[model samples]
Target chain A: MKFLCTRCDEVMKLAGAQAGDDTVGLTFSCPKCGGSFAMLTNPAETTLVKGLGVQVGGRSEPAPLMEVIQSSVARDTENQITWDPGAETRLANVPPFARPMARKAIERFAESKGIRTITAAVMDEARALM
Target chain B: MRMYHEVAGDGGSDILGQVGKMMERLAGRLSLIKSVIAVASPKGGVGKSTVAAHLAASLARRGARVGALDADLYGSSLPRLLAPEFIGANATRGEEGLFPIAGVFGVRVMSLDYLTGYGARASVAWAGAGGSITRGPVEASALRELLADTQWGELDYLIVDTPPSVGRLGDLTALVPSLAGVVLVSAPTLLAYQVTLKSIERVRALGVPLLGLVENMRGFTCDLCGAANRINVEGEMGETLSIMGVPALGALPYDQRLLKPAGEAGPIEAVERIADALLAKIGGHAAARA
Candidate 1:
């Protein structure tokens, strides 16, 4: 997408970019008027752009293939929820293929209740809620 | 309001140039492989994945370097069908790209299942406005990422197991510019034949070469006496093939042995036959062009 500077009737150049938790801020400057403009993207737009497997500003080094997928998977596991041994055992009962989703669901449940650690009792409660 | 001059190379982000570079990388990766074929069907439960896995195995058994890609994001069964033990296994990532897991007969395999950490049941939710949205673009981009990023290296053949949908097939064809051809799989039922015809039309519409159709589950083969028995009523598949001007590659009788895990037994004779015919067709097409 091209950005046009209405004040100077000149095309804007991407000056810089900053990535946030769920948003991306892009700064552009008009060469003719020396006017600066900044645009922020929502989470969805950020994801859509990230899905393109490209960076906002040109990268210093070439990105490895499947970087987006690798980062996304890593991000999913970066949450700080801890699982008790009993809860871990219970999670083992879930099919290996579904364990990731089950863990995510349980963690989300725990976080909703402001619980940091997931225990067998918490697992049972989450199961009951499900 | 004054006239707006569309400046060239306005020193923007150049997102389109990056996408073009990505495509160039994809093309470079594909160039190492001689043939890239997709086994596709329009509807599910027609044994498309089975055909794809066995086809790769069959080709690999014949001393060909084969790579199998499970492009079925939602219903990726090739991982289990090709390497059951590797199910839920994480893909090995190197500094350059992700490496495909070695399956039966040394056929390298890659699937989204490995990345998702959930085998086939993984729900691929996309981030959209306020909630999840339809996943057409996401799926396509994922496939493009897979095709562009996987360290497939050099191979004689790369068999892609496409999802049971024409849209996915189109996405794959568009993603891989070096696609050798496509093999459509269908069962012996009327519904399967109807859907297969639609897939054939879609393939032709995309202008990609249609290798042929494999009539999977044509009948059941009795293990005791080795007698082939017709399971479903034969439909107008033969007529449809003639009308569509597509060749009858081979008929794969439903064998219970295929249900057995990979490496327990080799690909059935019918699968081998399909593989041979596929090679011949691809060779013939290339020769004709040359």
Candidate 2:
């Protein structure tokens, strides 16, 4: 079951059972922000979720509760570029429309650098430590 | 009530009920995962992560589906510390919870260190890590995310490594709504013990049970004389913890090899015998309760 909550930051669990035909909608109150929202989980295909950072009025605000909870457990914020003054960009936090672009950017960045997501230095450090 | 909630090893579901209720409205399901263990220290360099990592690994080695949360967002070391190739992996977001990065022997790891590209570290130096994603300021935020999205796959334990200072909530082990207990770690130094006691007091307010005390870097044996003296004069300082109503879990003597210039394979397992004994205690407690 895939879904997102803004206040919650990431995936919150789906409580109800999967019903027959077409789409499955599960609802829950976010454990993080204490807000309520519904999730659409299908046995088929991925569910593209809107991130918490993007607000309804087209302004960015705290996410729905479910997203925060999901983000916490699954570590949705693992990929992010943070700036010195204070701006951090994460693919998960990016708007749904931007995910593909973000993923591509990450892929290109990985390729151009001649290093995969896991860095050579970290791998080297691995040898030294082990 | 006998105020049973105040003590660790009490084995009552009171703590569970209390924390569970706090997160109740938020968690959509029964949350099959039981026992969220946070390893914390008010001071850094006390081997908090080292102990927590090994505990997770040891638990997994015993056949439990174990997951390790490298909660120290900005300055995590678990990725570099684990051996072979399962060193580190970042968490992936999902509706259920954060799917942990796989580590050696099937142990799952989640860390922000992996989130920022390895080069992100360089960028972070140029920029900043967007505040202390470390367990300090972001405990509440992180805990919520952990519970909701992590793909733990029915694990027995979730070992969280917290930064030295509690930060926002201060002592997160206590402040966080859900947790079985807190494991306090300290070096043999008197200063370490003093800090540990203070940290424990902070959590006492949250009423979290103190699992026990672990004294790391206790001593280095004199190979020639066999007169095992602690790493330094401050090493003999685990006494206050005993007086404070917290049981001494184990005393890990210092070994230079474990802390050699480059070696970092998990504090040498501390005292295997003590670990086995402690395991027995936990096992017996679980079985008796079961």
Stretches off by above 4 angstroms in model 2 are A1-130, B1-30, B83-97, B118-139, B166-178, B223-227, B235-238, B256-271, B277-290
Candidate 2 residue lDDT tens string, A1-130: 2334555454444344343343446555555665666656442311111112111112223244334233322322354322221112344565633433344344445445554443434334333544
- Report the C-alpha lDDT of model 2 over B1-290, residue by residue, as the tens digit: 12334334322213334335435523542155555677778789988777776677666666777677766655676655443232222344445454556665566666654444442242112121223332222345444454444556766777778767744224344334456667778886678777777777776666666677777777777889999785656544446666778777786676654432112343255645444644655554456546
**TM-score per model over all chains:** 0.82, 0.58
Query: What is model 2's interface RMSD?
Result: 17.3
Alpha-carbon RMSD, each predicted model: 7.6, 14.7
Instruction: Report how large a share of the reference interface contacts model 2 reproduces.
Output: 0.05
Docking class of 1: incorrect
Highest-scoring model, TM-score: 1
DockQ of each: 0.19, 0.06
| The best candidate in terms of DockQ | 1
| lDDT of candidate 1 over A23-62, digit per residue (tens) | 8999999889989989999877776667667788776666
DockQ of 2: 0.06
How good is model 1 by TM-score? 0.82
